[model samples]
Target chain A: MMTYKSEDIKKMNSIELLKNLYQLNNATMAELVAQTSFSQSSVRSILKSLENKGILTLQNVDQSSGGSCPGRYTFSKEHFQILSVFVDEGTVDLKLKDILDNTIFHKHIVCSLNEELENIIITITEKYVVNCISIASSGVIQDECFYTDHGEYMTKHEIALNLKKRTTIPIIIENDVNSMMMSIKAKQSCNNLAYIYMSETGIGSAYYVEGNIIKGHQSFSGELGLLPYQNQTINEVIASKSAKEVLEDMFVLILVAVAVTIDPEKIIIAMKKDNNLSLTKIKEGVSKSLSKRYLINLEKSTNPLEDGLDGLHYLGILKLFDLYTDYNREKRNG
Target chain B: MMTYKSEDIKKMNSIELLKNLYQLNNATMAELVAQTSFSQSSVRSILKSLENKGILTLQNVDQSSGGSCPGRYTFSKEHFQILSVFVDEGTVDLKLKDILDNTIFHKHIVCSLNEELENIIITITEKYVVNCISIASSGVIQDECFYTDHGEYMTKHEIALNLKKRTTIPIIIENDVNSMMMSIKAKQSCNNLAYIYMSETGIGSAYYVEGNIIKGHQSFSGELGLLPYQNQTINEVIASKSAKEVLEDMFVLILVAVAVTIDPEKIIIAMKKDNNLSLTKIKEGVSKSLSKRYLINLEKSTNPLEDGLDGLHYLGILKLFDLYTDYNREKRNG
Candidate 1:
């Protein structure tokens, strides 16, 4: 076990301390001491400090057999707080979550990606209780992780550095498509997958293998939009905001491509509630295209398994933020 | 330290033993004792008995301090072996490798897939000595995991359960594209990647995320060939034999679509060695297509990253077998 001396425990931030407790599986001090990579004495001090703040509660367990005195400990989920913001072309969703991927609070508001975009972001962000923010937009985010007006394309690192000045909490910016991919990848059903998030505005993808998302060179891989469809237009297939275009080209790009390679056990498509008609048309078209392949004798054939996510859901956002934190920690440490 | 008593160990087939050893990182008795979930003494006994046979070796690391006792251990790579067979439409390559991924021996021969396919597979396989055997091909292989084949449209998996009667080595069968994807995904350089492999017959893809290959519903995914290409077909653009069609359609299907969606940090194009002229033409065409999009910028602008693999390397077959075994074990235990 790593020996966390008393002084270190006293100086720890709420985020760090919460992670420590979470690592203990929400167990009490005695249980934590046995399970943790941290030393026993340090766990006791941290537990006491958290309890003093009224952020935790202690419950007594039965006495240990043959022991002179029974053990006691404090526990808390108060440290589990984070703010997640997902920004799209004209909207941003803010959410607060606990470490266990439970939502505390959330709100959504419409906004423009105009010249005053930064100011609008700050104004909207002030409403959330959680300060730990992560943003996913429709453009390329640079290494420092800042967005540009250019859709899904980061201008430079200077913009990211500038954004850092406005926020105290570490802000992680990513592409919206990639975020959804990471979200599905973290879910039990989509454990090993190559995701295709075909939205009305554009197409996005996230590749997951070995329980990790593939962020290619400069964290810019899985740009499925750039992949060619018919007539030299990749977006025409999966990203057309026009329902007719989406219906016309969906099968040629998303479904056929997905069916042929990495035959993912499941494919989850995210879209708005009203787009069911377009989605149905797409499903039929794709099934027809796949069936045309004479050699493909599927043991069973069904509509490419499709699921929808209401982008406004707090549970989904909380899960997204949790995954982002997990992603960041893995990269930073591993 | 699974307290696998001698009886449990005795009950295990060679494949099971190899899988356990691989997961253990081929450790020695002492190291295994410290790491396993099993009892320390049980591990020590298992190591002692296995070492007694020629199955494994325990070597001592010389002490930096002269005259000190040496620390001894075993490396799994030194003890395990794999026989890999790569079958093509008209040829086959048979080889044996140690767990360290070294080829102990190899043989290449021409054979027609249309004639006596099973007999040819058995004949080539008989020449190797190994604990596990994996085969990959270009077509869709059914339930049998004995052999793998690649093709112009979809890949297949077929396993020869009867092979157990011929050799103690476990047999793994998979599609060539999936196998290659697994191989690429396993490489530290290409972890979490969307890779494009263009061979003589067609274009295909394999995706890696979080160190896992994305195997879709039919156990076939990464079918880039089905994604349409303008001017010519996708098959023409990706397959080695369709030089004219590939050259003409390269810009329309590959570069533009790749840039918009699956924005891979590095787009690796696998081609044939002698097809340099066609490759250059395709590059020029793709560059012109990609230059139109500002976001289509790649670190290697004019020259895309490309490598050539042996037509019958069957790299993904070996990897998919390992992944499947791990998945199977996790499934059984869970």
Candidate 2:
């Protein structure tokens, strides 16, 4: 199924170079050549074309290495802006970021799903020329919609339909756990990885195998909270009682479930910082059940909110590239 | 990490064509051109070169559809012969397969692992020009060595080393569950798949995500038997008593674990043909816990042995290509 030839590389050379360049802080023609394994002329022409189109900017760094060439190139960060909306049970946080991931605006509100989301987008779009919207929610998200949990008053809600009607920009709606996993993977670089996130919105888990997220045959592939425990679901056990009380057994069981199934290298546990869940205690409990023969890094997320946003921002960049970057044709800027 | 370009296509073209051609029965030049996006001339020249090298045979059939063209080209199945060895606790089965996957010879012996394997290879090599050896065992297999279950007299065995001393051929040692999953996947074609195989060798599982197998952070990724149950490992529970006694609750818990983790579309259950484990009972048990909101196909393997051999054969074919097929360089015959 993975059949391919070199002509594919020749076709996708410019896109690959641009994408690789975007990943770096700044790159030289020599660096680009090494990074892409393309000829120096190919990198030179592509960068020149991108600079002419205002997609990239040439920074005149005083480096004697490039005696006869232009200075380093920086991907024009402000070329495309992203509005990342993170919605949970009782809170909504929005950050307007440039293509370079520089936050231009930030706001938070106490609401579930209402006109407030549309208002936030309007507020952000009014200030900055946003190119895409990335919506990361606590519950399962399908297409441009979000599906909340059972027993919730508002079960389903449209994510960015109002904004869609007003703007021709692209939008992405994704499950919080999956997006969280993506960003954490960017940091951890764990090919086979699992993610567990817990907060006021409750707990959710995601599985990443190789380079792809195992969305399963279903949308809710990582609904760990729905797993059965002692006469109650995992969510019920945590919801009714202090999570600390049943944390050991719950954590160990989750370890077993994930470790036996996907066997990820790192299982990132993202929790609300104020939840008072001790990492040492959790590790001690897990170590008692699992031996050191197999090294599964069970660690806490440094900052759930920031990491989730990172993932959302990366998704936004990908969405923007999908919408605008067509190397086969003329460059279309929104 | 997945940044790639199309020139990769130009380099890997003929190899891709040969690899793809091996998967099919026979294809006309038109079909080959369509299969590969390459122009008709590119396909024609490649096929002609392959036909000249005796790697492919041009067949002539009485059909007006081809017009002036040769009927079809079948990959020369006799290009390479592979020795597939299946090792279990009680018995070991060996089959000699051609590149086209035809069984050239077959033999079964009542043993786990010993010098008998090397002797059999020596026997096969004296008659047939064997090019590769694929060893599929019940327990964990790493590198060219096979690690058997605990309490077994022979825990570690060097697989086909004595024969390797005689012939410079490719040899692969893989876990049986993984091989079983590969072949079942070829039939089922489930993108996200989990395989549970129950035979005299005991219960084991393998996970497949996207197009890659989740071999875990460790080599023994699919050691499902080691999972904790009621006061005993899942393997110990099944080993100590009749699997039928603990089948329902055991199956239910497994379903809950796998469903909550990597919610594969299909969970293939391969059991011993003689064991009277009813699918109805297993399905009823699983459905009691899991709701109808999501669908997961839990079916039995029609023939575990045949499916596993198919996977091994496919692996053998890939190994042959890796060792012999070089589109950029002159053809090497061993």
Candidate 3:
């Protein structure tokens, strides 16, 4: 959280200019001058400096889209790159990508729980990842270094000694769920949709609205596990060791009681194929218990169970666990 | 929608600069220069221009926080004005406020619906609201003016025509529920929490993360009423007339079903005082139904008799329906 000084901002603007040229592919000096509040001379001067740095290429004047006259401009993609990283307990994935979300190169490595976890992880990153380019990650990486639990393994004194040895690039660390949210934003059809990733051991949710993820203060806003509950909360029921046991108990007691009571828009039961809790069994159990409430004959009489979950049946909810691997990889590496 | 041209973007930046200044509470030229990408000269230039237009003042300046030297700058309050209109089928509430959301003045009017409803509304607005002020409303007010149905008499087309006539200020139209979401944001203790305001008429949800309300695409995302219900849809049961007529239709058929399913953190039930449906009756109804599932003793249990709804018993559901009125004005206007 470096507060911007005047000189720092000027340098940041220069970097932004390089990024914009890379993002736009090509732009005339006049276009930059018009698009930005910067004067024509300032834009020209910046373009010249960028060209000298081998980060841009000047093109001949061309006809404007509809303007009175066309203008010459500079464009380059040489210096355009993003280093994203995804970090989790024992695994870290890092990638370099373009602004278009396309990965240029990527690598995944495992950091075994050793006595020197931090030093080992940092060493691997410095050697295999950061030597030539930038890095991005799934875990919270800040200030061009890994904010890992490395210090826990090594003493606080040793941790500082290890980090000083490597030349770190600009790194953007993101949470796994946030990475998935960004991937969902890449989808063409998804608008105002929330992505809830029910992993093997945890229930995580990412809310997307207007093509951006709803990241709250401290970036821990979507921790649905902490949401209040009676008897037991959603996280306790969904992500705990006694999840199945609790479900079995609630099946007769709370599940049926509440199923007939609080009817949500869609009771999305997000799970994988390996789970013992099948949508079919859940639906069957619900039907038998709440027979008086939901008329089961609706499906047999009118429309058959269509493509999606419908007709009071615990319709097989959106299976997103399959996308978890890609989501994780993209988040850490990109 | 008018695609932002380069010229329009420049104007938007100017407006954003002005808004940011208002948010910062009249910062110095040095503060403005540091907070934004503008150079000292550019900041001075804009400050002078705005002061000339009577929108800013060259107030005394002090040393930058933790900096070596002190500097002078201008403060602007003239442009810190907002003309907000809250429109529903029953009434239109127009208010003028400063950037700090302090209301300068307000007017509430009732109008009859007709084919020319938009014309009537626009005429009233043009007559009352100041020109070139930033305009916002509890309806889709985009591109100076756009028509949208207020779910009652006036068609959106009529509203659009009037908006076309008045294009002085930058207009931002949003859903009434969205406006309520903003109001809720202003009232919340935590920025990451979700708010649900359930009234006799409908249920309004406002999701906040990082202090910004989640506005779904086309601003129609939180149409929670449209979420598919079990056996039926939310709109078919919750907000429909047929269910309301059937005494316990909404509770036994709808509200109870939702309680057992989604299990929201807190569901505030805002209702009218001395209304036909009281919280006591709702709890009694739930207690009777849930007895089969859980051996709940309403007499001995603290759940049902609580001031607000707790666990499965929605006892204090009436607080959700807020009797919204100008409380401050009632004392003054009286």
User: Candidate 2 docking: what grade?
Assistant: acceptable
Task: Work out candidate 3's RMSD over C-alphas.
Answer: 14.7
* Displacement of the residue A315 alpha carbon in candidate 1, Å: 9.5
**TM-score leader:** 2
lDDT tens per residue, model 1, B1-334: 0112223233332223333555554554555545444465555655565566445566666455476644555534433556666665577666666655577777677763333545654665565445566666665555564233333344333235556555555666655655555544434344445556556667666555443555555644565666555544466555545555544455345544554334454454554443443444555565555442433332211211111122123343334334433433544687
Error of 2 at A214 (Å): 1.7
Native contacts present in each candidate (fraction): 0.47, 0.59, 0.06
Q: Each model's RMSD to truth, in Å?
A: 10.8, 4.1, 14.7
What's the DockQ of model 3?
A: 0.08
> What TM-score would chain B receive for each of the candidates shown?
0.60, 0.84, 0.49
- Over the true interface, candidate 2 deviates by an RMSD, in Å, of 4.0
| Per-residue error (Å), model 2, residue A236 | 1.7
lDDT of each: 0.49, 0.72, 0.40
DockQ of each: 0.23, 0.46, 0.08
Model 3 ranges with Cα > 4 A deviation:
A1-48, A54-117, A120-167, A180-195, A207-213, A224-334, B1-44, B57-84, B95-107, B112-129, B132-157, B166-172, B181-197, B206-213, B224-334
Where is model 1 chain A poorest over a 10-residue stretch in terms of lDDT?
A: A299-308
Q: Is candidate 1 or candidate 2 better by lDDT?
A: 2
Candidate 2 per-residue lDDT over residues A158-198, each given as its tens digit? 75676688767788888878888778765554677888887
Q: What is the TM-score of each candidate against the true structure?
A: 0.59, 0.87, 0.50
